[model samples]
Target: MEDLAQMTLDLTDRRLLSELQRKGRIFNSDLAEKVNLSASACHRRVQRLEAEGYINEYVALLDARKMGVPATIFVEITLSTQADEVLEAFEKAVQRIPDVLECHLTAGAADYILKVVAEDTEDFARIHRQYLTRLPGVAKMQSSFALRTVFKTTALPV
Candidate 1:
């Protein structure tokens, strides 16, 4: 396997990635045509990209409202301590909560920021009571609910 750090993308590879980012389910032949490569060659490049960890797993982006989870909350968490063990314990505990879609450690007033989803405000209350409050070393937690999502995308610019 090629080292990811040493892997440089050429023009053709960039084209291939751009097409794939737009439509992950596009046919190999179609992708090849778009990138001006043979089907086999395109497939090989895709495989190599995956093997080199350039492309992670592909997933279907679901509609939260349709999936019965419409509420989106961003929670800022301040830990009681910045100790390694406290951070580790908090991260491990937060991972067990299914409602938490993303958690990021930040350098600001808050130690961590969490993106969470729920069916509604009532459900969010339950999640807060059941999970958020139970996280270890939590000194403070402030939550902001998103009224609407202006724009969201999973595709990364190549």
Candidate 2:
């Protein structure tokens, strides 16, 4: 019963989201037309979705390679200890580094996962030394460079 309800909600949300994903800069009237909803109804639905924490934020996706951040790296970090103070300190420090765009506390072989972008190898090296390696509680670090992004989508496959 719950699954069916979820599916129904997901279907409607996906229809709305797919339209927005294709054109963030598009007007709400156009969006309503595409989604087959009255403008006011569509507006209310979008507002409700935002209020309920479904639509986090609309962002302008950048062309990273053209923007000088030609290198994309996934960094795996293992901390020395899982003490609250150590974890909080490490998290706070990582947030200060602009290159560390995304960070996730993990459950597998690694403690944290970082999505980092840098101008070049030298820039990444400097970030590694000054930011990641020196971060409190850091015991081990590994990085995976992205050769290409085959698919990156903000819209959920609802």
Candidate 3:
């Protein structure tokens, strides 16, 4: 398979991806119209894009507030050591935590950064007591709550 970095995206491919990112559920015919391609051609291009791993998966973006998980918390975790086994164990544990939306191994002061969501601070406290505290090799942890989200988007510029 061609590497994504090596693959060249033509203008039409970019347009198709941009449109799909904005509206994953858009009909093939509608997408064709928007990208100025015949329906059959558009279908083939979309299929090729997916096969090439340009479009990984389609998902419906949900409202966090409506889902009863409005609170957004960013946690910076510093493990006791940078040992490979400790890092692997910590990552494995985090993957099982449903509330942890994302986890990143990072450089700088913290070994890892985590994005967590919950119903509220109290719920987060429960999660902390249950999951975060039990994570392996944690030397320090700091969390910050987002008060408001002024801007948020799932679409990527293709």
Best by lDDT: 3
lDDT of 1 by residue, 61-85 (tens): 8889999999999999999999999
lDDT of each: 0.93, 0.85, 0.95
Each prediction's total of clashing residue pairs, residues at least 3 apart in sequence or on different chains, is: 0, 0, 0
Model 3 TM-score? 0.95
What is residue 34's positional error in candidate 1, in angstroms? Answer: 1.3
Which wins on TM-score, candidate 1 or candidate 2? Answer: 1
lDDT of 3 by residue, 115-134 (tens): 99999999999999999999
RMSD of each: 1.9, 3.0, 1.5
**TM-score of each model, in listed order:** 0.95, 0.88, 0.95
By TM-score, the candidates rank as 3, 1, 2
Stretches > 4 Å off in candidate 3? none
Error of 3 at 115 (Å): 0.7
Cα lDDT for residue 127, candidate 1:
99
The segments of candidate 2 whose C-alpha lies over 4 angstroms from its true place after superposition are 1-10
**lDDT leaderboard ranking:** 3, 1, 2
Report the C-alpha lDDT of model 2 over 1-158, residue by residue, as the tens digit.
Answer: 54344323555567887877777778889888887889998898888777666677888998888889989999999998999999999999999999888999999999999999999889999999888888999889999988888888776666
Candidate No. with top TM-score: 3
